[model samples]
Target: MSRRSSFVLAALAGALMLSACANTVRGVGRDVGNTVDATGSAVRDVAH
Candidate 1:
């Protein structure tokens, strides 16, 4: 295959993989945020 075609195929595959990862990335972010919040709350409780 030509270089241009190979580049396009690679870009398309990367885009698809990134799109699939978007949701899980968001969920992971939320999970981390929640965990941090819980830890902060626990620390506050301990301090108080």
Candidate 2:
């Protein structure tokens, strides 16, 4: 039971770390592209 709990925790931590890294990379990429596109300013203004 203890080992199983440890494994679960480890797996969860690994997934969280991987997702964080992926999100960071994606966010950076999006930011660069968004800058080029003006970050959808027209859409945001309409929504607001």
| Per-model TM against the reference | 0.60, 0.60
- Which run of 10 residues does model 1 get worst, by summed lDDT? 15-24
Please name the candidate that would achieve the greatest lDDT relative to the true structure: 1
**How many residue pairs of model 2 clash at the backbone?**
0
Global CA lDDT of candidate 1, please? 0.98
- Give candidate 1 misplaced runs (Cα > 4 Å): 1-17
For 1-48, candidate 1 gives per-residue lDDT tens digits of 999999999999999999989989999999999999999999999999
What would the per-residue lDDT of candidate 2 be over residues 1-48, giving only the tens digit for each residue? 699999999999999999999999999999899886775887787899
